[model samples]
Target: MTRIGLSPLAWLDDVEVQRRAAGLRRSLRTRPPVGAELDLASNDYLGLAQHPRVLDGGVAALRTWGAGSTGSRLVTGNTELHEVFEQELAAFVGAASALVFSSGYTANLGAVVALSGPGSLLVSDALTHASLVDACRLSRARVVVTPHADASAVEAALAGRAEERAVVVTDSVFSADGTLAPLRALHDACRRQGALLIVDEAHGLGVRGTGGRGLLHEVGLAGAPDVVMTTTLSKALGSQGGVVLGPTAVRDHLIDAARPFIFDTGLAPAAVGAARAALQVLIDEPWRAQRVLDHAATLAALCDVAEVPASAVVSVILGEPEVALAAAAACAQRGVRVGCFRPPTVPAGTSRLRLTARASLSDEEMALARDVLTDVLAAR
Candidate 1:
């Protein structure tokens, strides 16, 4: 590959410079298997990722199933664990059927595109996850982006749409600020408009509703034929992979038509095992969910926030991305680790420090976090 006057990719340098100037550049930091830092950053809300039972389950599955799933689920990857987990998860969430995917990203991609097509209309929230955004882009449907958490706007779009088939998409617990979608109003709107509702419960599975049955179950819409749900095993479930739960017909359609599900490799056996075990832990120790919420409330109060968030995440907004970065560094220096979100992880001018509340956070860890945040956020 010979270059001409300038390399074809030379614009990347300019892009990097622009990103650095705008404080949009991101770098990865390697974390140890076990760290001493007081962690308020990760999404392990119930701290089940480190639980002995979960680990043992993963180990057992690893030993029994080897490492990889071999191939796509159509060919060889669908194992006994996948079937059992899917059945259990569907039953837990009150869905008729469930289908597993390689990752939450692929799951979202598969669900959105499979459910909505060229002739369909998709009313998506402004602040949905990037996966869903990309899914909409690939869906080929005429997408109408509604204002963030505006059920009225969503209803308006759905009500006035010319397409008979419409799908409304949103996150149950938004990953950015940990705010919740107006699910009841949205569901009502969808029902009124005769549209299907797809709720991403990625952050809600191990944190929200009774025993973490999820927001759908909390609001009595879990088994509704028009309602579909997607979630991740990585976050609260403390594992890996993703799932789509809904009517058995929808599950059958995804199996046959969703590109991600048809082509992508199946979920690993270890993740299936871990998610199953963590889910059981949640069922047995329902207090874990409430503990996470209580921790979130405490974090909000310590940060001097006026109201607590709906999920196990609390957002502390600082102005510029640079300012947020500095604040995060200060907190880390004081032995507290937090999520420093900048564009495009968050919208411009809304760059914030996202804190996670883990059920297993010790009193000492909580004290350390409280003082560190009080001292650090004071400066910003």
Candidate 2:
């Protein structure tokens, strides 16, 4: 028998084993209950995930179109539901046109790569989502990371390279902190620099703007020639898929050029139907968005009164990774489940218990969540 040169692989496994021993290992949980529990850990900002109409639409689409979209959109999977959702979403968000993809991850990948090329410079916020980072990597563009949410930093970066084609990208709402970006400043800077601005409204839609039109519309940047927006239906819309809304020419270009949209499988019919229904619910219940924001503000106030930093995600900051994990476990033990963000998910020294707010939670439920969370933080 010949011994192979696998020492590097052995060292890698050894590091993983050490990480597990240090109370830093990661694992997945099985399906949680859907009953009468306070949920402050989900992204269903408007509480449409379990809406009756959304559920019914999903069921109807499943039965009518079968389980899956048979092929890629460019193949046999392009269906009427996709077209309808695209049109409705574009009109609702005030975009010139829209193109849907299988997932937000793919949409970001396709759009970022397609729009910016070798000669292009991609200036992105340092705290932008991982999807955008992946897209920049795949684009092979000259990438520059600006300070998070600092439009002045973005302006400085663009000023240094005014001659190169550029695209400015950032999340409308920072997912971790729930901080809103300076969209108007960023848009204005990009426009002046002759660069395109791409805002990922994954957290903003159904939670901001008039009728949840999103942060861009809230900042009066919607329908601008230099702005493009991408969103996920799985978040606020309580469905699964992603869309890029921009000019008609951009959509046409994506139809021919976006590899993820053309080469990947189309979104399931159920998701399309559920998204459409969710949008209708948003149209009918515009106040739901405000209610969610109100709930968030209330929770933030509760945290602040308790002397904790008021997180947009309503997180309880724990200085150490184990302390954060222990705090979350304590909450779960007391009949409340929350998210624990440690290294990799969080920065090196800022592990925390992330609590997402939703409109569905009653006042009593929010109070209980606060009571339980306060106890957990004190114990930590």
Output the number of the lDDT-best candidate.
1
Model 1 agreement with the true structure over 1-380: per-residue lDDT tens digits:
55768777999999999999999899997777997798899999899899999999999999999798999999999999999999999999999999999999999999999999999999999999999999999999999999999999999999898998999999999998888888999999999999999999999997888888999888888989999999999988899999999999999999999999999888889999999999899889999988999999999999987888789889998979999999998988877889999988888898899999999999998999888999898877
lDDT of each: 0.93, 0.86
The best candidate in terms of TM-score: 1
Total clashing pairs for each candidate: 0, 0
Q: Any runs in candidate 1 off by more than 4 Å, and if so which?
A: 1-3
- List all candidate RMSDs to the true structure: 1.5, 2.3
Query: What is the C-alpha local distance difference test score of candidate 2?
Result: 0.86
lDDT by residue for model 2 over 201-279, one digit each (tens)?
Answer: 9999998899899989988988898888999999899899999999998899888988999899999999999999999
Error of 2 at 186 (Å): 0.5
Error of 2 at 69 (Å): 0.6
Ten consecutive residues with minimal summed lDDT in candidate 2? 303-312
